[model samples]
Target chain A: MKQQYGIKDIAKMLNISVSTVSRALRDAYDVNPETRKKVLELTEKLNFKPNKNAAALASGSTKNIGVVIPFITNYYFSTVISGIQEEAYKQGYNIILFVTNDDLDREKTLLRNIATTSLDGLLISISSNSDTQDHFEQLMEEGVPMVFFDRVPHHIHVSKIMQSDFDGAFMATSHLIDNGYKKIAHIAGPKELNFTQERMNGYLAALENANLPRNDDYIIFSGFSQANGYTDTVTLLSLPEKPDAIFAVNDRKAVGSIQALKANHVQVGLEFGVIGFTNDPIATVIEPNLTTVEEPAFEIGKQSCSLLIKHIKNKNHEPHDILLPGKLVIRQSVKLSQDS
Target chain B: MKQQYGIKDIAKMLNISVSTVSRALRDAYDVNPETRKKVLELTEKLNFKPNKNAAALASGSTKNIGVVIPFITNYYFSTVISGIQEEAYKQGYNIILFVTNDDLDREKTLLRNIATTSLDGLLISISSNSDTQDHFEQLMEEGVPMVFFDRVPHHIHVSKIMQSDFDGAFMATSHLIDNGYKKIAHIAGPKELNFTQERMNGYLAALENANLPRNDDYIIFSGFSQANGYTDTVTLLSLPEKPDAIFAVNDRKAVGSIQALKANHVQVGLEFGVIGFTNDPIATVIEPNLTTVEEPAFEIGKQSCSLLIKHIKNKNHEPHDILLPGKLVIRQSVKLSQDS
Candidate 1:
């Protein structure tokens, strides 16, 4: 009636696919820069602004971001959420939470029923048990902007941010080796997680650098918990050639290892050395303060949220892979010198 | 159009107020039972159903609940959230989270800008610094259902749930006295919080029952943190007459007190004794393992969520006050006996 035009009309005039015009309108990175420039120029000349699309893109319109995580009752995750919340609050956005309790089925179900209309974007940390990318792929196809942090799927081509697990593990293993521990054991997380695999590879690389033999029995892959660490340590202790030191996937597991070693009347700092990833508060509380790699959890959360907002605003934003480094925190858990 | 009778018509026919008819339709607890029955019978006979109103009352119409909390980084709050998430998930409700970081201004702003249209109800634990109930009252006036948990306002007539702080504190102090610790000191939370007052009262009641002196010098009120506990303990130690035992409001403070006492070369389990509330995991990790009263954090969260759902479904549901009991958990922090 009033010479109103749609993206379809723009596509016809430019001799391009409707999707290409739509992507161009949203300033998607995949769209050719020259083509996007032309599309914007033509739209500005024709005053081709769709009311509903304009309103949807307005600042703070549905100013909410959904965060899907595995658990909230742990130090690492809760601290990460704090960082995300701080960033989101500063940017005038609200966070809606969905917890999967590390169960894949619940993660799938939660993702399936997420109300995309109410959320501007999503920040997800895939569950440890998640083995498929189909659920996330479907959401992306429906035009829901998302970024994954920490535990993430392997194949999805989206923004992902996490701590440098491989580098941290290498540092942890090298620290143990430097402390004069002859044979070292590793308590790892679930075998399926790529981070765990990366950590294992780091541990392997460190052992190879030091010209140590690879003992499959010394590496135990299990769940991420103190109990897992305790059981894994007990299994190591029962071996014919017990390891003199242990490197845990996290501080909780390291604490468990300490408890198990202490229970067996072994001197934690003297007879055996222990190193952990994630310098959790429990590291200080444990009898012998734990030596660990401090993950850049807060930075990961902030950057992931910021990257997600970019995607939400510009639909064609290029995917990014960010890996923040971790520092080794020296403490009493590992022996300081061979003489001591 | 067929003569569709609204709630106003039903109220006129029954010679009752429109508000009364509306409350009766929703099975409100405050209305007279006989009046509600009469209104229901009349509505049934006349087939009086308002489409929009009925649709608003339908199950799962807005299957989202907002959870406003002070902090998610602590063990107590995180455990409570786990319970809330479990209950809400079971009821097919998604949770939207708001963290105030225990700041009153942030809490007020969060409450003021909360989009009621997106949430069916709210589950809140006000910040430690919040000194007013006006924001909550305004939300109630808008007919939004809500339930307060843990840290709640004093006068609001809303469904509130918390632990039996007084009883737990009394038990902790009494345990100290029974073990022959004289000159017991209490390190507490913010004086403005009712729970902290209740805990202080419990400590006083125990001292009175034991014929011990009521010394204001022995009580210190401060923030709830390990740092607070450490500073308070340092202050206590500097007094001309030092305490023989310390009863902390929470385990974090207790751990700090232990650290301070240990630093001062005081034997925690021998020359001095320490007891704490909220048997946090840190309680076990602290040297000489802390003795404490375990708060029913999970139960409080589950019950608060369940109660909020009741308020959401039935607008007339009565406000409730629930206090779950805590029990004494004995460990090595306190001396076992006077002879020892």
Candidate 2:
């Protein structure tokens, strides 16, 4: 094993005072330029970095941002994290992650136990059924800078970033309508989430614009998973008058819908139609290549991190709401009016 | 916003002294059990938690573990993280995440700049082509406890946890041989990765046992992506004598090989056969479900975290090398001998 070296080692190797090496390492104004260069060269050659916690204690800034999300195994959230990591790397920050697994109790527990002094700020995406904002409000009251993204709280006046869920849902529904599908259905997420309500409203507005009669049986609210989609589609197929098209909240659900339809010998593109949000890689892998509205997941991550850093640097930074648009990716899953 | 509550607030509400409340929070022996019960109840009701940084200053344990990974977008890596998260949560430890994006330079920078004092230990899966371990060696020598997983270093004596790559590869190749495929090709990963070498060896051993000639033209080394699989398959097809079967290193490449075979009008399950490693979710989504080996990714993560925690708790703990076995999942991609 190699011997551990410290600032004292650097000073001894260069035959300089310990204070001079420390000052040079921090690029202090009083240190000579030549000494600073020498210190930097030696540290780099030895692959040595100054202790950040010591510096954090002195400066009262840990340079760590805590990210609270419901899940990380999914494509959308993972992509967003990549964006956040990119921005944090560029700005000299580290992220401490906490996963809630979409459980409100877990979310509450994690927030309650969080070590606020160890983090400069937080980036949170609340649970799907988070009914209370008491824990978050308490943290905010303590002057803990934070920003919310994607699955955010309803009334919190914090900087928030997310995709235009309503608009994307509207575009998806309209695409089906324009292709001559009068009877349409929606496989939605839980009723408590802000995006779920927004998407449902968008779907309703599309039907109203098309002057199509609304049917209560056509909308099914459930969890956000492929299995949920499969079961919901099965329920739709069991209807006396089955819907001709479906708009899913996310791609995994849409893929499930397609599978269910295929199992029942229903031609997906030609006979029935399906469209989804979040252009996950699975969208392309699924047969017929699902058409979807691509959420700006990575951009949301990058911007949220940037905004959180702003809050960290300037505690007085005003909270702002940013909505990114989603683009419609056309593939074989959605049939054209002419083809029909 | 609500008022931020603290230990003083709890004491004031309970009509107790500040030190008494602090002692109760830490479960000090001098504090009365009834007083401790009251403090715990009040803190839970208010969702109040002690400042961990201050506690860590006094106790010298940060209760944070840093996890360094290469990528998070894929299924296997994400699932592995889920396992780690589960264990960390159960142990009451928060995880700090760092992504290297499979770049050796990024890995070096992250390791060199890591805040060792802020973390109790580390769990790492080095980049695919990590050729040097000096940075890791320096940190280890500094008394930083760590455990390696999956893509670990070649010569490091650190505790490591990984799947049985060689055995899985042998099983996959032998499965094809048993199915009456005399000629087989292998689509492998980067030449420098440890698993790649182990898998190649397994494939060679299987071929030798079957009395099959090892054709150097049938083996291709490339990146681990579906595109690489497609291009590699295309190259194999261009050979004077194409192999009757193929064994891919992972599921994504296997999917690509299948797609390429379809594009070339090669009957996948009849005229040829294909097998892959890693039972990613996409295995079922592809037309003829992928039959491959299931790497114990989640188990690896859980065990690695557990081992690291042991190292953190006991500085004199002996290093361990744990190898997990993989299971072969039968599906349509690999045809039966009679069908072939």
Q: Each candidate's TM vs. the true structure?
A: 0.83, 0.91
Q: How far in Å is the alpha carbon of A132 misplaced in model 1?
A: 2.0
At residue A67, give the lDDT of candidate 1: 97
What is candidate 1's CAPRI-style docking category based on DockQ? incorrect
Candidate 2 Cα outliers beyond 4 Å, as residue runs: A1-39, A44-48, B1-39, B44-48, B338-340
| DockQ, candidate no. 1 | 0.20
TM-score of chain B of 1: 0.82
Model 2, DockQ value?
0.50
DockQ of each: 0.20, 0.50
* Model 1 bad stretches (over 4 Å): A1-61, A338-340, B1-61, B338-340
On DockQ, the leading prediction is: 2
Per-prediction TM-score, chain B alone: 0.82, 0.89
* Fnat value of model 1: 0.43
Highest-scoring model, TM-score: 2
Candidate 2: which docking quality band? Answer: medium
